[model samples]
Target: MHFLNRGRKLVRTAIALAATIALAGGGVTATADRASAAPVTPSPIAQAGTAAVKGSAKDGYQVYSRTSEAIRYTRTYDGIRVYGGDLIVRLKNGKVTGTSVGLAKPLSLSTKPSVTALSARAKATSAFRGKITSSGTPELFVDASDGTGKLAWETVISGWQPDGQTPSRLHVITDALTGAVRGSFDEIESVSGTGNSIYSGPVAIETTANDTGFSLTDPVRGGGYTCDMGNRTSGTCAVFTDDDNLWGTGANADRASAAVDAHFGAATTFDYFKNVHGRDGIFGTGVGVPSRVHYGSAYVNAFWDGAQMTYGDGSGNAKPLVALDVAGHEMSHGVTEHVVPGGLTYAGEPGGLNEATSDIFGSMVEFYANSTADAGDYDIGEKIDIRGTGAPLRYMYDPAKDGSSHGCWSTTTKNVDVHYSSGVANHFFFDLAEGTGVTAYGTSPLCGSAAPVAGVGREKASAIWFRALSNYFISSTTYAQARGYTLSAAADLYGFCGTEYKAVQASWTAVNVAGDDFCSAGNDFTLALSAPSVAVDPGTSGTVTVATTAINGDPEPITFTAGVVPAGVTVSFDPATVTAGEPTTVTVTADPGTPRSSAPVTITATAPSVTRAVSLAVSVNSSAGCTGTNGDDVAIPDNTTVTSTITIADCAVTPSSTASVEVHIVHTYIGDLVITLLAPDGTAYVLHNRAGGGTDNINQTYTVNLSAEAPNGPWVLQVRDAASADIGKIDSWSLSL
Candidate 1:
């Protein structure tokens, strides 16, 4: 197998250019199918306080079957990219068939930010941890992945992790008006190595005959070729050329061996998506993703660089990370990014889900290959022996057996690394495919006393997962959102809440991910917030539109009321009672005396037959003056309380009715710590009481009112570590009075 690696970039660029021209909007631009006439502005629920939702759409890509076609659209609002706002439309012949939208609701907010780009970047800089290399310009957009629209400024902070080896590209989202850090996700997704023409024995691979020799390039599949990196970290790779078309002898020394595995993997994974899911190719438009094997002298990991795939020779340069499933796993990352538009952010719950997605498809592809030398199984990296223990890197049946991965969802699940945190979804998938208790794969333990989930078979499970990924999931999807979307996918595939849907729910519940019985009643309604979040100054007011739609239920009168208003705030809903298809105006007024802080105000919507509640984020602000910070790191001894101090000098002013406490702590599980800010007068305001389930780190801003206290002395940032084994340090803390 021989290929010219020097021309790789140029070929990819040409394919991309063709796709752009075809889509009618270069990679970033979009074209909308807006009607020729002026659009109706009264639709989409956000009927007050904003102008018409101006937007456009461009065809990102499309796929086809015998009689049906699916088109993907990359969208923008007011001239800005919309994160989690992708749309997919399926049609038969010239008629509409189905459609999928990533946005929770339509965008109807100002693109302009109250906070300047400089200010937003500074906020992002603080949220970013580790050593800094460079930063990106702040971009503005509407973050509507959470069922509501928010004007946000996104800043990408690039750097190295604490280890200085693993790089970081953290995208931090900040509220444009309040400057509060809203959300974050990393760019670098990681996975370890394993492979064989060595792992798969002597497998048949496709190659293209060239003037010089037979090259390891598939002419039938977008001319995708596998090249050797010559054991270098980065350089031009050479295609493995051979005198004869036959290649690989089941040895790592033969570079063609790894290339065979990689080439075959790319082909098989492409076939899996095309034959089973109706997706045409990796890019959905016949564009093949190139692969570079033998990436480093002794690299132990492999990764997807957003454009192509790269594999490393493991320890001693004896093991190439090019196993069939490994290749499938790496390429599936590209698929996730391609199919989901922006791909799931590679951090927190989203990252874990993304990793699990790769693993799931990797196993499925192995099964699809049906090679006698390498049988499909639930274990990951088993062929490579990644840990040098003859055991796989992860056991889908019982992930915690590795002593790191989470076997079930918990308060601390989202706090762990993406690889280990992936155990929850991984285990859930196993349960869905093989059922609970014991199976051919292994024994999968139930999270609690939850009922068992019957096997739905791998085909059905995979279809459900793919449907959710392509149709329902977006970039900020959490395990909770995943459960809902998968349920919807299951309903779409099978009948609503039928055996397949119930199996999905039961499997999720068995993994400690609780969800409502959405199909329990035929009558139901959905709620969406026009403005999900707002930053209001003390003595000021902000409004949100509570929009409702009837779902599987008759039109009924729905009553809206405040369920969780802050102590010093008053909430009143205009037209408190309306039909299910109507919208209500919710105004929250923060009194001057209200503490300067943020909390979720729940608006409960009740109908005669059902009840639903949507939460609104509210933060109160005042002029900042009493500011202090302690930047020293304090070791958080297990099960012990540690304190840092910040003294203020504002003698005349008390404190903002709601004051902000920005704390940065590097911890294994911040969910195990109770963090409270103590006033100089000994009054304490609790910020976090062992939250986030099982997620890690406490590096964000928290707000609460400083009540009846003088801002003239030391204000203590107190953290109590209530867990054992895991530990961290209080990196820094700041006070805004």
Candidate 2:
């Protein structure tokens, strides 16, 4: 947004020329056809003129004099309609020589010299009007024929559509014309690089030749300088001029690839405007414009000098500041100048507003451009390498990073240096466009807890600011005025009492720029602090933790109140009460916060002094347990011996059930022991137990008997413990059949 740049000065001379374009005062109108007046008759004036006037003047006058109040016209001599100024007949060697006249005014002849000039003047005056319309370029076009539809001149006429940054005027001029087009040039303004370098320049039929550094094969200097793909050097550096023999030394970069990079970057910027912002070029109309790069000696700035964009390679400490953002910034100045009269002048708040306006739109263009090579960020001049310390020119998020002088603005902001003073407004834009929040526009990551606009988000904030910029805020908008304009715009765009309107008011307050009472009455600027919202996973089970914090600006402490915790979830906070200036984390936990399982838990911090609510995402996790059954347990008697029947549990999921269980006993003595299996209900079948004593412990014979009336299912076998040492451990056994 800074106006003083090295390259800008070099092109300073051209500013006056462009500014001299008459600020016409008319609108667009329809032109009438005069094709019938194509032939015959000559005027004494035409005969008095040079032999070059081979055609008939009467017919030409008739053809050219077709009038239309709405149309702008130029000059007409003996009816030969032309776009430029007056016409005159000069005598050379006693013969009619030729004609010449000023393009700004027209000429003709009457019976007397003074009368003829006066008549021509009157006719010119009557035929010409100052009004300009969007006929072709974003410029002021004159009514060459006094609003009549006629060929004003053979000069080339081009058009440009301003991208709303400035007044969209059609550029009209009268000059010697040639090429395929005849009598009048009628091609629409060609837009290259879309919005990158919006201009009306030559439509080169062929592409520019690639510079392979073929000229560098032979060098006058003994020392060789390498031209790598990315390396850039000042075009004024000795090596640049000596090795490459390029004229610009010291201030410009002479890399072989710079031209391509600059061109592509400009093209990308243009495309960004056209594709993203819906602009034809720099101006909304497709105006062919030149994108001059590598300008001047070690120049460290870029600017749109009323007509074209100029870039300069910075000093040793910096590189060219012609990045996409810089390009957008310069082009935006053109837009500003078009829309706001005297926008370029530096004065008071309007000046600061002007600067900030450029920065804001520059950033917007970057955001809109959204190039892969350079993703849009709210940072300015990050790639320029000015400090050689990796600090951008300005930080929209935290302008204070540069210095306090350039940070947030107050009433006294106008007192600071223009560069630093600019920050206050820049910061306001940042705050207004992006609320103080955790995230901005999705990609704009925020610093810890410095949320923009307190309660609202960046998207709404940007919309409010954009509307304010285009609608309510005038060229001389102050911080207070900005607040009001944005509020009104928000209400209009989002509806009265809508979240957006309230958010806009709150955002202005957060930035300390609250507006009048009318807009502020319904808007709340107080921080609406609440706990974090609930986040969930897909499946399984888990817990969600909710943390609470009192909104910083809240007048007093708030009592933490929990909202509906998810099923299988729990909620709590580190410190239930949130004291002023002390933010508390209200933790909401889920017993089994399973994966993909989530619920919304709102934690309201309410008090007579203040009220705030924060939502936490209570979620479950599924990554906790293994896929199958972990382990199993079984029990068997020691002394008694008997075959035990047991069924193992399968690995299938059993939500809230226990595994099957079984018990068995064995006999260790020589005796007639019978083992009978019985169900828990006392049902049994056959019983059989046998023991042969080989080591004198016991000798027994077991008989297998089947009861005819026995019901057989799962049964138990009972046996007695024979050994003395194992007697206490082995409880008694019984057979049920």
Candidate 3:
């Protein structure tokens, strides 16, 4: 999940102008830009600091338009680009208007890797088992998601899942120096569900009539076809073909009975996304996804394995995991991954969002189909008695009815399993679409002190969520962010201060998610950081920008200062001050020979009436290495492969030396990756195959005995993505000889 790039224009209001005028303080003057017809002067604020801005004046910051009225400035530290460090300055006809900062403070840390690329790969391998398909070279990354940053190695491992046929792509994050696994997540999204001796009963399905008679394939809908796994574990399954135009008898007694239900489910799901959301297909392309039924003997689950959908038979081969909602649920996983960047990070709050996204759409698909055999409802997996007690797998109307799922948000919400954590969002969606108390779906109880929420209707609710998922929300997004993004989506579709937007806020409140009321204060002044934290090497320095933006108020002067500084580190600001609606640079310097450690530094921007403080993660390290990286972000176009070259000129390493190669790639689907390293002599070493199945990004190192090849020439790194419909990029790479 990532924030989608938008090019909409912002509407300025009189309140914003007044706020700017009121906030301007000493040494700050308000001016108007006659050309742009907006304020051109700085708002009220004071500045204090001694650190002079260093570096070439022309090389300081580069501005690019974000929205029509906002221009973003990229941040750097001692010449090194700061990841996630950027500032957005809103302007109207070249006048200072408002600003939004991405970085909390400058980065001050060590730029060294203590762990070898080979060691990082080994650690990743141990954590990710199964058939090793593709293993990418590890690259150094600044981990700043927690408001503190650290140098970590990210490796992408792809291959067949433990079940063999199911593809698995696993992203492993390791401590760069310690080689300890920090975290990992699978890219494939799956949900447990099932079928029957034709439990769905007779349903209308579209099939292709071929020379071999009617086949269980929908030629009309992206050539989608269903095959039989034959209760086996490996190899390609055969597509179901019948001598006649008719399919299975509505009974488990016939082998094709389950296929009928599976086939119908796929068709309904495809139609749901296409007709309801205007999506072309699962991938938003006119491509059909393959569905395989009869997966393992008594497997009792279904999953969207990154590339295709697979279903299992229940105990006694009596239950096939292919219900209407289950089919929609599994297929929606594909839509979510393809729609969102890195597909919601597959863990924590994002993971729950992923699951809930599927549930929401799955239920919607069921409703769209309106199958009499399995009516659309808030309950999931109710038709399939997976629990043997006629109870559904989950209750979206009142998630807590399941005993483990939470209906409201809490501090511990992220700690629960993704399936349960999803309850919070699921309940919120239900309340938003149908309201509280008695309704068509059922009675939805409010959580905590939240008031009753009015319904926005399912159509509007789904549109709002789909818009948010596609346009807002990025990887590492928290529930609070979801609330904001949903509101933004509603604003885009309905109105900024409209009923839909307010209902979006109230729905989240009903789920106990707070602070979303910020939307209510339209045109209010605000502060934000592009990145919450940053990392720097010892003896080196980094820079961050502070920005102040007015939603609907006058630009004011804002004072900037460092709240906390480590003993060995000093913080300074360029110009030592700033006015609201303008960006100021903050530089952090670490003394030479400083001890390596992590520190949390806070940067505060204060005005006469309001003050905001943001946290920064500073890490100092002692590890060192020789590395090379791609200066610009390379785009890997769909269905095409790209290469990035890392030239190593006069290296002192001998031909017989064992060299470690670290490659870092940021992509959505690791299963499509095939990475190779070419020595100076044109000798190619396969570092990774298309192994990771559906996992996001590749970060791992490969160690090879380059004793036979010279290390002084230009080495080329090649990357190929076998499949289409998804794309990614090679972030950077390093060669430690």
Model number with the top lDDT: 1
By lDDT, the better pick of 1 and 3 is 1
| Candidate 1 per-residue lDDT over residues 1-737, each given as its tens digit | 33456533211110100000000000222334422345654211122112112122321222211223454555567667666665555444544433444443345677778899998898778766689889999989877655456889999999966645445788888778767666677766556643332476555555665566577666666777778888776569897777667676656777777777777778788778889888766767666657788877677776665666777778777877667777677677777887676777666687789989988988998899888777889998777777777788888999999888989898667657788888999999999999999899899999888898898999999999998887756666788778877887897799776999889999999999976446646667777554457666667877666666565758789998887666688889888998876667777888875656668888898988989887788767653455766766688999999999888775345676666788877676667999988887788888889875455677667657675677789889899999897787886788877
Off by over 4 Å in 1: 1-29, 38-186, 192-197, 520-538, 541-553, 561-568, 572-587, 595-645, 648-661, 665-712, 716-737
> By summed lDDT, which 10 consecutive residues of candidate 1 come out lowest?
16-25
Better candidate by TM-score, 2 or 3: 3
Q: Per-model C-alpha lDDT, please? A: 0.71, 0.38, 0.66
Order of candidates by lDDT, top first?
1, 3, 2
Per-residue error at 289 for model 3, in Å?
1.0
Candidate 2, backbone clash total: 132
Off by over 4 Å in 3: 1-112, 128-151, 155-169, 192-197, 519-523, 526-737
TM-score of each predicted structure versus truth: 0.75, 0.37, 0.63
- True lDDT of residue 478, candidate 1: 80
Better of 1 and 2 by TM-score: 1
